[model samples]
Target: EEEEEEEEEEEEEEEEEEEEEEEEEEEEEEEEEEEEEEEEEEEEEEEEEGEEEEEEEEEEEEEEEEEEEEECLEYINFCYKLVISVCCERSVVVVPHKDTSGVTRHVMRGEKCWCCASQRHFRCHTTCHARSLQP
Candidate 1:
């Protein structure tokens, strides 16, 4: 009877040890699963951040392009306005004066004045008569 009791106690101890080991293995598996989930979440967050940054960079580039286009248009309009100068005779268009000295047949920036023009053209007159053959 004493031998039988000792054998039964030894068998119970072995079963308890096996149960503990199984529980430990289950806990380890849970921890591994949790860690894997966290890593996956981190990867997703990184991808989202990268996409957002790219979108922001593209928006900034577009805005810069729009600003450049607007500036170019304004510059073109201003230059055109300067090119059409008002002559002295019939004053309609007003523009800044730039002297192109001794330039006949080609009027630049409005008036063909005394110093710059030939003898026939009056001050501020749009009409320019061709040079006479006589001296």
Candidate 2:
């Protein structure tokens, strides 16, 4: 009878140890699942932030392009005005004038005097006279 009681006790102890081991394994699995979920959440947040930054960069680039286009339009308009005032009006001249210090200044002065007058002088004069109804 004593021997039978000793064997029973040993079986009970073994069963208890197995149950404890199973509970420990389940806890470890739950911890691993929680860690994986947290990692996934972090990755999603990072992706969203990166996308926002890219959108902002694209907006800035578009604004810069628009500003450059406006500047180019202004330059073209200025050139048109210069051509009209200098090439069409025949007001360009290379003359001598006295400056504020009584020094003689011989300067080629006009709206577009930087252009080659020798090549366009005849055409300009004819066009100007025709447009003005002059003889």
TM-score of each: 0.63, 0.64
Per-residue lDDT over 91-126 for candidate 1, one digit per residue giving the tens place of the 0 to 100 score: 434433233343333333343443435543233333
TM-score of 1: 0.63
Residue-by-residue lDDT tens digits, candidate 2, 1-135: 899999999999999999999999999999999999999999999999999999999999999999987865664455445545654556654333333455554333322322233444443433332222211
Per-model CA lDDT versus the true structure: 0.57, 0.59
What residue pairs are clashing in model 1? 88-124, 89-124
Candidate 1: lDDT over CA atoms? 0.57
| Candidate that scores best on TM-score | 2
